[model samples]
Every structure is written in structure tokens, then in C-alpha cells.
Target: MMGEFRDFVARGNVLDLAVGVIIGAAFGKIVTSLTEDLIMPVIGFVTGGVNFTNKFVLLGAVPESYTGSQTDYAALKAAGVPMLGYGAFVTAVISFVLMAFVIFQIVRAANKMAPAKPAEAPAPAGPSEVDLLTEIRDALKKA
Candidate 1:
């Protein structure tokens, strides 16, 4: 069992998958930062400085123990307020779309860089064994 586990871990596919997962996690953080910090800010600025992060709908009354501002989404949520955080959902969606687009471009570029496989040539035609044997018998009769 130990040998089997070692063999599984040593396989190229498993190693590649591990590397890809690590790189993908790093890439996801980058995409999330790009979406939240850069793109969202620019979009907010374009739309008259509207901050989307605080945009949410209160589903229930805030907890009596909560001391945060009513308009602050993060603080209210942290204080156990029940609300629909649609702005965070939108941000996540944007991040996912950006990550998907970037991955698609990478795959497209990789496809373009890869060499295409050449078509296999057809085998040459030849006489059947029966024809060769018949020819051999005719020659033997003549001899």
C-alpha cells in the first residue's frame, strides 16, 4: 500500500495537477484583487463614485448587541445582521468572469503555439498472398 501510494504521488499527471492547483490558487487571488481593487474602483468612479460594496438589502432587524452603523454592510454583517449581500456577489461574479477570460486566452495562446500533428500516410497497395501462390504454382508446372 505504501508502494502504491508512492507510485501514485510520483506519477507525472498527479504532479502536474498539484502544480496547476497551486498556480491556479495564486492566479485566483490575483484576479480577485484586480476585480475588487482596480476594476470596481474604476467602475465606481465612472458611475459617479457609487461604492458597490455597501450595496445590500436588510433581510431582518439588526441584532440588539450590534453597535455598528446601519449603512455599513461589512460592519453590520460582522455584528450578525441578516442581509442579502448582492454587491459582494456581483464582485465575485466579476472576478470569476475575469479569471475565466484570462484562462481562455492562455489556452488559446497555447493552442496557437503548439505544433499540429501531421496526417498519417496511407499504406501502399500490394498483391494478395493467393495471387503470389498461384503464380508460384504456374511457374512450378512450367518447370
Candidate 2:
């Protein structure tokens, strides 16, 4: 069982999959930072300085012990307030689209860089079964 496990781990596809998962995690973080820090800020600036992350619909009353501002979405949530965080959902959607676009571009560039496969040569033709049978029939008639 240990030997089989070792063999499975040692397989090239398993190793490649592990590497891909690690790289994908790191790439996701990069995309998240790109979306949250850079793109969202620019978008906010363009839309009259609207912070989408802090936008939410409050469903519950603020707790008596809560000290944070009433308008603070993060604070309200931290204080156990029930709210629909649609802004965060929008941000996540934008991030996903950006990540998909970036990955598509990467794949496109990789495809362009890859060497083209040569066309396969066609197989040589031989006499058909019917032609061979006809020849056999002629020989049998002569004999």
C-alpha cells in the first residue's frame, strides 16, 4: 500500500497537478489584489468616489455594545448585524471576469508561441480486396 501510494505521488501528472494548484493559488491572490486595490479604486474615482465594498443593506438593528459608526458596513457585520453585501458580490464578479480575461490572454499568447504540428503523411494505397479476388477468380478459371 505504501509502495502504491509512493508510486501515485511520484507520477508526473500528479506532480504537475500539485504545481498547477500552487501556481493557481498564487495567481488568484495576484488577481484579487489587482481587482481590489487597483481596479476598484480607479472605478470608485471615476464614479464620484463611491466605495462599493462598504455598500450594503442592513437588515438588523445595531447592538447596544457596538461602538463603530452606523454607516460602516464592515463594522456593522463584525457587530453581528444581518445585511445583504451586494457590493462585495459585485466586486467578486468583477474580479472573476478580470481573472478569466487575464487567463484567456495568457492561453492565447501561449498558443501563439507553441510550435505547429506537422501534417501527417497519408498511408500508401494497395490493391482493393475486390481486385485481388477478381485476379484469384481469373487464375482459378485458367487452371
Candidate 3:
């Protein structure tokens, strides 16, 4: 059982999967940073400093005993107020689209840089085996 486990772990596919997972985790961090730090700020500046993450709709009554601010999503949730966080959802959608676009561009550029497959040599120009055999049979018949 230990040997079988070792053999499974030692497979090339397992190693590739591990590497892919590590790279994917790092890539996720990069995408998050790109969205939160660079893209969001620029978008906000262009759109008159509107933050999408704060857009929400209150669904439930605000309890009188609630001490936290009403407008804050986290605070409202903590205070047991049901709310729809549309801003956060929009922000997430934007992030996903941006990440997908970036990955697409990366893949496109990589494909362009990758070496092209060598063209297959054309088949030798000659009579095929069946044709040769037919000719031989015809010659034997003539003889």
C-alpha cells in the first residue's frame, strides 16, 4: 500500500498537477492584486470615484439593538440584517472578466512565441502498392 502510494505520487501527471496548483494559487493572488490595486482604482477614477463593492440593498428591518453602522455591509450582516451585496458581486464579476482577459492574452502571446510544428513531408510520388500489383498481374496475363 505504501509502495502503491509512492508510485502514484511519483507519476509525471501528479507532479504536473502539483506544479499547476502552485502556479494557479500564485496567479490568483496576482489577479486579485491587479483587480484590487491597479484596475479598480483606475476604474473608480474614470467613473467619478464610485465604489462598486459598497453597493447593496437592505432586505430586512434594521434591529433597534444593532450598534454597527447601517450602510456597512459587514456591519449590517453582523447585526443580523439581511441584505443583497450587489456591489461586491459586480466587483467579483469584473475581477473574473479581467483575469480571463489577461489569461487569454497571455495564452495568445505564448502561442505566437511557440515554435510551429514542422510540416510533414509529402508522400513519395509513385504508383501505390495496389496499382503495382495490378500492373504485375496484367503483365503475367499478357505473358
Model 3 C-alpha lDDT versus the unseen true structure: 0.87
Please report, in order, the local distance difference test score of every candidate based on alpha carbons.
0.93, 0.93, 0.87
Q: Candidate 2, 131: how far from true, in Å?
A: 2.2
How would you encode candidate 2's per-residue C-alpha lDDT over 6-36 as one tens digit per residue?
9999999999999999999999999999999
Give candidate 3's error at residue 117 in angstroms.
1.6
lDDT of 3 by residue, 1-143 (tens): 99999999999999999998999889888988888788878888899997766679999799999877767887887777888998788778888998799889999999999999999999889998999999999999999
lDDT of 2 at 25: 96
Candidates' TM-scores?
Answer: 0.83, 0.83, 0.76
lDDT of 1 by residue, 1-143 (tens): 99999999999999999999999999999999999999999989999997889989999998888877999999998887889999888899999999999999999999999999899888887879999999999999999
Candidate 2 Cα RMSD after full superposition onto the native fold (Å)? 2.5
Give the CA lDDT, 0 to 100, for residue 126 in model 2: 86
Q: How far off is residue 89 in model 2, in Å? A: 1.1
